[model samples]
Target: MSTVSVREFSYNPSAVLARVEKGEAIQVTRHGNVIAILSPAGSPMERYAHLVAQGKIKLKPVTAAERHSMPHYEVPEDVDPVALLLAEREEDDR
Candidate 1:
């Protein structure tokens, strides 16, 4: 399962939902504490049912260790997007 901060989750809910629809489970956290868990439409085990049926997984976990953290970017609250866009457009006209 993967974890996402509330801010991150809310920032792009469609992207997160797309991942969940593809059988990826996600944990939503607030202030470092978990607040919700999002799973696929069916049972939690449904994601693996096909692999088990094909006799590939054997109902055992064999995941490799992962310790990478995703980068988080924050924009200053007072930043003006319209001004930035206008500035970029002006620069492009040069």
Candidate 2:
């Protein structure tokens, strides 16, 4: 890691950028105060690497065939919430 003043960076941006291209992190400064850091970009998969490693994220979505093969819970027959609510509302009007 290295620091570069804004003026110094402005004067020789290519040199600073070249260091970053080689995977070194550089902190940019203005008035001796740090403003930004420039570093090499990571691969797309790197974004989710941490979550996948923690087992909190799945790399691939569930396959349609697997979804169809899974047994599903069946709701009780004739148990319509909307119908029950409507019946209750009708009773309230009486």
Candidate 3:
């Protein structure tokens, strides 16, 4: 999601609308509080096709060998990812 202040939204609505039209979700905020969410009007596939027509998104077909070569990871059951992320964010504040 993307966020824009109420003042910014009022000043340049077209830019924000463009993002929404491209299937991005935008959060409108006022005084640091979220007031509304702007989303694309049509289905996700329809929006994606629109973006493709506008040259905003590109479609490419991956070869079978290419897919086989992709790397994957195995998560350890003992790891709590959310806790690790929160701890990392807290450390960054210092």
Which predicted model would earn the best lDDT?
A: 3
Q: Which 10-residue window in model 1 sums to the lowest lDDT?
A: 64-73
Error of 3 at 30 (Å): 0.2
- TM-score of every prediction relative to native: 0.47, 0.44, 0.44
lDDT values, one for every candidate: 0.70, 0.70, 0.71
Best by TM-score: 1
Measured on C-alpha atoms, candidate 1 has an lDDT of: 0.70
List model 2 lDDT by residue over 1-94, tens digit each. 4778999999999999999888776667787665666657883444554554454664454589998997564436669755766877899999
- Give per-residue CA lDDT, model 1, range 1-94, as digits (tens): 6889999998999999999989887767788766666778775466665554344654333344431343233447698755766877899999
What TM-score does structure 2 among the candidates reach?
Answer: 0.44
**Candidate 1 error regions (>4 Å):** 45-94
Model 3 scores a TM of 0.44
